[model samples]
Target: MIITVPIELPQEIIEEIVQLTKQRIKEEQSHQTKVNEIPPYPTRKQLKQILKIGDSRLNNWIMNGLKTIPFGKETRFDREDVKQFLNDLKI
Candidate 1:
């Protein structure tokens, strides 16, 4: 069930509310744009599962040339980077 309440406001107040709503929409769009710029970097555990590789194998790849972005104590790899790394490998 839905309920509706009737309220009255001055014309100026209504106009101000509409303008504020537009401003809020613009702010949300800007925030969304920034969020979209972030890369989908997978954690080490996730990468291991995705690639079906063990710890030693993953470490070996990292030692060779697999690029990793370290965030403090955690390591992450971009999806595209991992794809490129696999493509570069002849096997």
Candidate 2:
């Protein structure tokens, strides 16, 4: 056996809940858009251009443990791996 009851929430509370849900969905969509924009493997020139890092800085980062992936005739960087490597460097 089960019992059921119906309750009503204050209108302001309901509106707040709806607004928060919309905000959360908007944030998720924005994040997805940004994530989708990045290629899984970006070439050296593309990476440098996007990140605005010069050759010596890129070399220093690689020396400090940044990694590269070979893509056919050129070298590329894994987007996720690069993100993790840089995040790990944060103080």
Candidate 3:
């Protein structure tokens, strides 16, 4: 058995609770976004397989702060991004 009582709340108080809940949700979303925004860190062996390049060349690129876009469903790299990166390197 359970007892239930419906108590009326002041309109302002109800609105304030709703506002606070919305603020809490927004704060959580902001925190999650920051947490998920991590930079990529590719390994030497993996890089050799994916790029199908020589270790010497891959090592050269990796040492210079080269990284991929944040990985999603699959490991993907944009050719244009690579071009821009290489252009920046002047190599």
Candidate 4:
């Protein structure tokens, strides 16, 4: 024996629900990918290397808008923030 349930929903509403679910699943997958891939704070030198910028340029970026987390003598930057900064610079 098989049981079936029938429900009626507007086509637009169904489409919207499907889209939202897809977006949510994508976000969950993206978060999982980054959850264990990055460190909380990356050192300034490491950031410079990641961005492939010289010291002077890095200083210029820091002055422009890049943010840093200071821990006594060590300065670190959030990897996500750095990526966002670079993304924001795209024309």
User: Which numbered prediction scores highest in TM-score against the true structure?
Assistant: 2
List CA RMSD, all candidates. Answer: 14.6, 8.4, 16.0, 9.6
lDDT of 2 at 47: 73
Return whichever of 3 and 4 wins on lDDT: 4
Residue pairs clashing in model 1 are none
Full-model lDDT, candidate 1: 0.75
User: Once superposed on the true structure, which residue ranges of model 2 sit more than 4 Å away at CA?
Assistant: 1-37
Better of 2 and 4 by TM-score: 2
Q: Residue-wise lDDT of candidate 1 within 24-74, one digit each (tens)?
A: 989867754543443589888887765568999989988989999988999
Candidate 3: RMSD to truth: 16.0
lDDT of 3 by residue, 43-70 (tens): 4444455445786885577567555555
Worst 10 residues of 3 by lDDT: 34-43
Ranking by lDDT: 2, 1, 4, 3
lDDT of each: 0.75, 0.76, 0.56, 0.72
Q: TM-score for each prediction?
A: 0.54, 0.57, 0.37, 0.54
lDDT of 3: 0.56
Error of 3 at 49 (Å): 33
Residue pairs clashing in model 4 are: none
Model 4: CA > 4 A from native: 1-38
**Residue 1 of model 4, lDDT score:** 22
